[model samples]
Target: MNETDAKVPVDGSPLELALTAWREALGEAHVVVEPDALEAAQTATFATTQRIPAILRPADTAQVQACLRIAQAHGVPVYPVSGGRNWGYGSRVPAGDGSVLLDLGRMDRIVEHDEQLAYLTVEPGVTFRQAHAWLREKNSSTFITTIGGSPDASLVGNALERGDGRGPHADIFQHVCALEVVLPTGEVVETGHARFPGALAAPVFRWGLGPVLDGLFSQSSLGVVTRMTFWLARKQPYLREFFCTVNDDAYLWDAVDRLQALALDGTLKGSFFFWNDLKALSVTQQYPYASVGRTPLPDPFRDQFREGFGRWAISGALSAPDAEIGALLERRLATALEGAFRPVTFAPPPPDGESHFQGVPSEANLAMAYWRKRTPPPQAPDLDRDRCGFIWCSVALPFTGAQARRAVEIADRVPRLFGLEPNLALLAHSPRCLYLVTALAYDRDARGEDARAHACYRALARELAQAGYFLTRAGLQAQEASPSVRDASSEVVRRLKAVLDPRGILAPGRSES
Candidate 1:
């Protein structure tokens, strides 16, 4: 048999043997072998980017178990696709060689929603929109749930990949309460409180009885997540939202510092992000002040505008009564904007309301609304020259503004040192945890975009490794290429793979061997 050919029993009876075993293990209707069905199952959010080899849509956990059992018995590789909407990351397709896609889109259902406890349990295939709708129906007054990527993205996939979003509850990993995973050996295993016998209705705790195995599954090429439960922040009594622009070059660090202070001091309650002028212009056709019918800044006034205005915005309910929301906002704004850019305050549009500042979705707003005007669909800049592929490099550093400034300085100079333009996006994960530095290479499809991006990435990866910057899953591929960065931690992760997935069948092409 060819090396890439699906391994089947040698005797002419092997194919028959496998088919009979699968049918007996799962009902005939649960097995899909038709070419069109396979093709449809393999479709992904970023189909324009990656290629999908084979797709298997199992009807239930039993079918999934049967499929995996067959794959392992035959030495076939399995790539689990929960929603297939992980756009920039590997998407929903497998990254390994000679792999068969295992799609869980069919198992989508909200298992449970405990409004009294402020938590929801859902399957891997549940989309953010579905979860949001379920939560709205269950508790109209519940706090806004966290969401990542697009509304169509899967909640389980987002949580497993540690997706980030806006608001105080943006860190999805922290919100994860429990998980139901299917091990590689075709057995179902529940982690955390769900593991204990008769503990179905027990309180959700991410870590408890023993070592946390849930963390191992996250970003790992091991088990597939079938279900998960996550805690949601309860709705606060009062809410306030505001946007601050920093156009002056000198205030760049000042802005980072103020935002960091507010977040650390518990004043600002949402994830904070900084956008460059180019990125800012891409999102809004009219400046917030100008769009509201205020006097427009003259062209000569442009130079006075901060070089890179950090959209230092905050979103969260106040701990105090409704009457105190305004005072809290003013105090937070005063401390965060002191000696920095001019602070502008605005009320959050009603939940059903909209604002150019926060109403539009951030990710889509940046990808579609902002850049689409200058470049048409599929017209992203080339990945070579002035353009480099963006990598998410989040490092835990001091919470002070100086640390944030250093991060920006490194982001700017590092790309330029490799002969690429400095186009970086900064996001403050939390006041004390880590700072996310996203280096944007010009879109590779754009003219003269290829060479610089590749070279810059290679160079930047090496520099970051030497600088002791720990890489997250977002940069896992790039980190593997650097010797300095691939250490014992990564080695142990690999060894864990060999033990959990002895057959090397799960997500075969994604991480290093």
Candidate 2:
């Protein structure tokens, strides 16, 4: 290769050589080689740490392809991050050390929004808040499903990760129609019908004529998703938020059974969540470490919380075209589990209430991360700045009440044994299964807190896995928490990786298990 084609380094390290080539491919202004920035890029939201050489900010698909080409030519690994707000899952940190972070934050663009079709195509950098605002500005009657994540979190990134939220299309990945992926070898590819020229139904239909390749890109290291079209939920006339409580474990299990049936039958068309008191308290207020002394808040305080909010709470939206249908659905929910749960009530959207179903993103859920912090959290909480350590172990469980009860019992007990509060919730995204999401919160500055948090998470994960409950999402620390992969399946994955990314230049340690 000539000098003009690519930089040839003689004295500098491999990373330095790669940096030179990247700066040329993407403008120097787009390349981040500063030590402080590189260190920040290597830091996840929790205790795990890795050293990334540099960060390359790609603006568009062409730039992403160029960056990948440069990395392939220089024999340097590249890790792609859409928004760097992965939080409990390893934020912007690369899977392996010495890799350069491929940050796609600059590609924020809403390519298309068809109100009649109820779909929106966006770049990887488009955030939930941005898309919500865009729809309102365009006077569109459709909205995307938003998660309880940071407002800055990428819409495409979260969907590709199969993140869940509260809406008609709460299962984010299922709503994605097509993807524009940049392969490891610097080739650009489009999933679904987008591969064909002038594909009119690319954004309308999810599956193409032949094999469905969209699932391969999500939750895997096969390719980098540059663009995605999401099927948006329609904004109906009659909309109301509902809330109910379960004061005891037995009642909670029964309620889960009833809710499962409703979800499966489409009575509860919107997604809902059942979160424990600990999760409820963390979101409302910080842990009273000074008054309670970390002794599991006094029984009196617990009683007060139970009287006001119950031991566990379930919240979701009931949206319909008219009041009569909405009332029918509410009546169905009321009679399904009569007297099993607290008084179920539906109210108008409060002035300050969250509009998550309408796709307005908020960071209120992030308060759980700062539960152990002494200082007050800011408007936009920063986990690293507040020294709040967090790790999320989200496992999939059957929709049966028996499975939920056992999972809750194990989740509640394991963290207490490790001197940590179990902030747990059951996200019922699908009718057949729910994600039992548990968060391990700790103070990073405290002595041995990091190590303790990791140990607690590992034990919790192991116990859950042993009980036949395996994680749906695995971070760097809990990658092994997944069920044992069969030899045949493992070999198939290895062989596919060898063909797609032979050098493993794309996230070497990012396990899809």
Candidate 3:
């Protein structure tokens, strides 16, 4: 048989032998091989042609180990998914077609919640909503960092993908303390102090003694993360939303510069998003495709947005321990913006509402995924379930007005070249640099639009990489952006993959591997 031809075979074949072992390891109830279920699992938030034969629902670390061992024995590749909410990034699809999907959603459990230490150790199935509700039930004083994606998205899954959230812990992967991973070879290992038997500081201390290995699991198919511990941020006493605008390029440059300075000076603790008007408009309402006649967002729509929200709209929050500190931080932010930009507005906290900085997760951000859809968005937007074609291409840029301008300029010009409107934002994770995140939204069901959207995404990624703005995080569709093996660092990554997973069965062709 060909090496890559792991497709399900006729009855009584080696593939059936592997399935028999899997069913024995993790009961018949856990095995999913029906055609409808497999087809549903194959669907992604974006367009893809990959096929999956079956999904293995592993309930624990031992089950994960058993599945891996079975796959290794039968030479059937297996892929792992935490919550399968990766949306826009290929969802639950495997790296290669015909690979068995190992779903960890059945392992949802909050193993430990140390109230004093402000840490939560959870399994791969634990979601943001679950963690939040658990903390509330326990009346804990801290909350988990939440992202703009689905609340049902697994924390370990997002952390493994290096996804950003809305609070001071916006850098999700950096905040995780320890990880319990099951290797592709069926060995289970723990990072940091967790490696030591009965080590008390396992969940608190990040670096135990030797070289740090937690980062190795992130953005790589090095292992299957069964459990992880995240250091939660303390709930602040006061939080307020802040908004401002830059009507043109001249003001946008200065605004970004001053915000970066404030972020560096410790005045801006949480993430602040600087979104272009097109993004703001999309989230607020869908594009009027009927009125626009399918060319692009008509000039009238652009003019209307310009009148209401200028060229660039900035929104974020300021959180503090008390009113006194909050007022001082607000004053500092204002002083940084004084005379540099106009029409800036700072609003007090709305009555009885939790802000994103307070670790509240919401699905409102998913509205942009349906911007190009013909049907109206549902009351609760579920993009993957709805089959919306959305692709996120994010790259890193130095936190400077010049760099931000160039990145946004390319973002604007490239999408237009492909007859698509650019939905763009500059996410400020720190003062040193920011992530220039752009999404290409289209209708997946529309004939030929998927190819168009894919082409536009490739073009944008290629141009952005060539312009010195390289991708910090990429979807499965963006694997083509990976550097060639000719680069010394890339060659090193290839070597590491060979050492860790010689079979190349753990998420083949993933980032830097």
Poorly placed runs, candidate 1 (over 4 Å)? 1-51, 200-203, 285-321, 352-363, 366-396, 414-423, 439-452, 475-487
Poorest lDDT segment (10 consecutive residues) of candidate 2 = 1-10
TM-score of each: 0.79, 0.95, 0.96
User: Best lDDT goes to which candidate?
Assistant: 3
TM-score of model 1 vs. true structure: 0.79
Window of ten residues with lowest summed lDDT in model 1: 381-390
Show model 3 residue runs off by greater than 4 Å. 1-8, 339-342, 350-353
Would you list the C-alpha lDDT of every candidate in the order shown?
0.58, 0.83, 0.84
TM-score of candidate 3 against the unseen true structure: 0.96
lDDT per residue (tens digit) for residues 1-513 in model 1: 223333333564534455566667666765555555544433332222233444566767777888778877866677887877665443554665446677788888888766677777788888876766666666544443454356667888887877776666667787786777887878887787788888755446677578878887787777888888877665555555555666555676666666666777777776656665544443444233433322222333333333445433322332334646658666767665665454655565346322212212323443422121223433342211121233344444566666666665666677656444344446556677555444433444445444455555556555655665544545323434544434588788778888878888777757542
Candidate 3 lDDT over 1-513, as tens digits, reads 222433557787767888999999999988888776787778887777667777899889999999998887887788899888888888888877778889999999999988889999999999988888898788787888889888989999999999988988889988897799998889988999999989999999999989999988888888999999999988778788888877778878888898998888889988899888888888888878777767578768897878867788788888888899989998888777665335557777755335667767788888999988888899977787788989888899999999999988898899998878888999997778899998888888888878888888889988998888887777778866654444487677778778877777777756753
Rank order by lDDT, top first?
3, 2, 1
Indicate the residue-level lDDT of 147 in model 2.
90
